[model samples]
Target: MGITGTRQAYEFPAGGAPPLGEVRAWLRQQLSDVGRGTMADTELLTTELVTNAHEHADGVAELRVSVASDRDVVRVEVDDRRPHLRPRRVTKQDPTTPHGRGLALVEAISTEWGVATGTEYKTVWAEIPVL
Candidate 1:
């Protein structure tokens, strides 16, 4: 059950709109193919994380996912070119605002989340519990 090897993964352009629908579809297909059932929140999780990276760094250089079945956790990370810009916690949600809620949603749902800063790129990662 420990992640001996990679379960599944996908990648996108350095700074481009990652085909959201395709990403979601592929992930769901993979999950189901592996007999892990289906995680309903995956779509939202991917969207929030990807959109957060996209909105901030104009897009992500690449996105990665690693699942540790032993730990029952799925970690998703998005790498961006801007190391200075990291994800911040949003204290409150404004129903009127059209933007600025991705992190809040991410925080609300993720089992654990944080940022990994590198000299050239930064990766925002989140862990989702699997049942």
Candidate 2:
């Protein structure tokens, strides 16, 4: 992920609801602290994952960030407690998807992404690489 670039993590309580705005701000700060720009794509994708966790998942364990030395690539992960209910894949983007309630955008912006489900939790991660 990085030789001497960025590798950081944040933990949030997954009691009642996940605070989307707070999470975003923290992410931006972390990126900025490491001299990463917090580009639009990274911001948007991370928000999506967090929102999903807020709405569907039961508990959020952590948010991890990893950046390449050149800062040309970054990976963000949202880990939540709900291994059984992993994120579902959205094959098509519905033009009229309410306000924002789908993985379609994540699928579009992420360079690569997937879900990791363990016994007690599941993580939805997306990687954004600068072109």
**CA shift at 103, candidate 2, in angstroms?**
0.9
- Model 2 regions lying over 4 Å from their true place: 1-6, 33-38, 92-101
Candidate 2 lDDT over 22-45, as tens digits, reads: 877876776663344445677888
State how far residue 51 of model 2 sits from its true place (Å). Answer: 1.1
Give the TM-scores of the predictions, in the order they appear.
0.85, 0.79
- lDDT of residue 130 for candidate 1: 72
Q: Pick the candidate with the highest lDDT.
A: 2
How far residue 89's Cα lies from its native spot in candidate 1, in Å, is 1.2
TM-score of 2: 0.79
- Model 1 residue 1 lDDT score: 31
What is the lDDT, from 0 to 100, of the residue 35 in candidate 1? 34
Q: lDDT of all the models against the reference?
A: 0.74, 0.75
List candidate 1 stretches off by more than 4 Å: 1-7, 14-16, 33-38
